[model samples]
Target chain A: MDFDAIISNLPLYLKGLWVTLQLVIMALAAGFVLAVPVALAAASRNLLVAIIPKAFIYFFRGTPLLVQMFMIYHGFAQFDALRESFLWLVFREAYWCALIAFSLNTAAYTAEILRGAIEQTSFGEVEAAKACGMSKPTIYRRIVLPSSFRRALPAYGNEVIFMLHGSALAGVITIVDLFGAAKIVNSRHFVPFESFITAGVFYLCVTFFLVWLFKRLEHHWNAYLRPRETIAVPTIAATAAD
Target chain B: MRKLVTAVVTAVTVALVSTSVIAGEWKKIRIGVEGAYPPFSSITADGKLVGFDIDIANALCAELGAECELVPQDWDGIIPALLAKKYDAIIASMSITEERKKKVAFTNKYYNTPAKFVRRKGSGIEISMEGLKGKTVGVQRATTHDNFITGEFGEAVDIKRYATQDEAYLDAVAGRLDLLLADSVAMDDGFLKTDQGKDFEFVGPGYSEVKYFGEGAGIAVRKEDQDLVDMLNKAIDAIRANGTYEKINSNYFEFDVYGG
Candidate 1:
């Protein structure tokens, strides 16, 4: 209720906002990149190719992110050999540990989403491509991937927002994200509601921006679907003639 | 539709099972404490809960003629979990602040210690706000140390908040933090004894702001548990009078650190 406290703590709130943004962006980018091959492996027919990534997705998704973060940051550090290993350089820092956990967790969910979308792509499209004598690699690159991405777009948008929210866990491992900063303010001012509300608003703002971005992306991707003249039939007819 | 029904039925079954287990009668009192706060409460290597609060909780339950169990909860969630009925009472070294008084009741203070800061020895750091400029400091999340660092040090030092004092201590030892701020007794008993904190030394005079740090650590009970609070307070007073408090205090700390 006090505008004074809110105004006074704006800088700290901004710092938290920045930290949250970094965590979300880095985690999402790394996770999406890792998710592509995992989804491919999961969808493949070969049991050997599919089993490992399938298990990885299942294990990360099954356990809570808090436990995963702890196992990586604190639990693994208990081993003296781990400290001496090359992994210590990354494990020693809380930020890297949180990043690794968030990336893995988001990758699991993203892979599942992408796998579902790839599976849903129309069988007719593949049949048409094969009828045209299109190569398997070409069929996948041109038809399967694009259509699957379009199908998965909306769901993937939701996942992006979830990843942003999940990044709050970084505060637990000592990364000074927005929640961490709000906690600092609460402890200092003894005004939990004010500080938390401010942090909540910051999160809401970021979420709104993400929603807007996804909407734009969805619109851009759907641009080819806009009703148009049948002139496009000429190009199709030429390809058919060939 | 059959799959939907199965999912719903399974969910309902699981919910009922869990609720029944949680809603069971108060045959045994489960006490919550931050296990990293040593001499007061801590988790042993074998995962058993021990320390002053553990012993006192058992003793108090003996007086109440009830079986007592200890539950380890992170410091930040301690109060909310108690309110959520996850535990019967909190014997953790929780200070009684006026803000907290609105939600929960506290017994008389059984132990008290002023908050202080610890830094690496020969780090050339003095115990003043200016000395901490540009240094990174650590404190337990949702604690008075977190509050004090922000209020006093502000942007002069980097404030790293952790879920446990032990985590903060680990970071401090790793040089991720230049200083760690916490209760004097906790620093003395827990951190000082740890191999990582051997080179760490306490700097500066202890400070307290009643508005944030509260009126020292007391047993937190539900506000409705006025009867329970009275019984616990009586036992606390009796123990203090009979020198049991001193006996427990001296066991963990070399010097008496109670009654700040």
Candidate 2:
């Protein structure tokens, strides 16, 4: 309600947005890297290859990220063996734990999304690549991946937004992300509306920016797939074929 | 025809539930409580809310001649629930502070306690900033103890804020945190006395400065409920004068926690 209070707290929210941006970008990048192989394997014809990725996808997607975070941040520390391990160094830091959990969770979801898109790739284009003596790897690299990515862009964009919101969970573990900043402001000032609404608008701005960015990417990448605006003309084959 | 009947039934049901609250009477009331913080409020094994805060709420309700139902709520959303009219009053051990006064009204404090930090028995950690440098300390988020440590020692220590005091205690016991901060009485009865918390001991000076702690824990109501506030305040005074407060105090603590 108090615009002045919200304005005064802009610095805190901006700081929070920076932290949120870092988490989202890092997690998305990591997830993208991991998801590529998983999606590839998931799209494989070999049951063994497909099953391995499927299991990883199933586990991460099945469990809640919050539970995974708690298990990493607090649960593993409960064990002496884990404490003695080198992994403890990363596990001890809430930042790393949260990032890993978010990355793994998003990777599973992104893999599934990419897998669906890959399955939808045109069989005609694939057959054309095969007829031209393109190897499996080249076919996937030049034909399938590009087409699948273009198709998957919108859904993946949605996943990015969900992950952006999901990064708010980092606050519960004390990462000082956007929602964390909102909580601090709310706690300090007892102004929930001013505190949360400020963060809400920032999230909205980020979402809009993301949506616009994805729209541009889709427009350019899928340009060839679009129906061209053209003048009606008779083809030369109609007159010459007979 | 069935869909039309269903629509009519749903509308009537919604309206009846919406307007059912008995206005201007304390005959029946819903009290929000977090049954997680032990010794103050917690859920027993049999699913009953049994603790000092519950006893205090019961005493207050008896004084008001009202039937009170203690609704368990997450501490994070307790205030919002009160604001949303999910419950009339909060009997959670919510500290009374100027910040809180901006949103909801609080009755006179039932009890007050200093905040303290507990560390491992053999850890040799001092409470000073230099000694606590690079050490991880855990406290429940949004708590007075959390604000105190963050305000005072944020530069010196790595503070990990938990959603609940119980979570902080668990981490402290598990050695994930070097130390944990919380209400002294809660630390004493809720954790330090428990088997899981046996490895840790209070290591810091108790913090009771009014600037950080404000007044004691108070029953909270919406700001517009002045009549309810007055009635609750009178009930609190009556409980104290009639020794009901003393009885509940003795049930929870060995010392006077009224903060007077």
Alpha-carbon local distance difference test for all models: 0.82, 0.88
Docking class for model 2 is acceptable
Lowest lDDT 10-residue stretch of candidate 1 chain B: B19-28
By lDDT, who's the top model here?
A: 2
| Clash count of each predicted structure | 1, 0
Structure candidate 1, residue pairs in collision:
A187-B147
Off by over 4 Å in 2: A130-132, A229-242, B1-25, B223-227
Provide the global lDDT of candidate 1 against the true structure: 0.82
Tell me the TM-score of model 1: 0.69
Write candidate 2's Cα lDDT for A119-153 as tens digits.
99999999999999999899999999999999999
Estimate, for each residue in B114-174, the C-alpha lDDT of model 1 and write its tens digit. Answer: 9988889999898676787788888887677777787778778987778788878877765
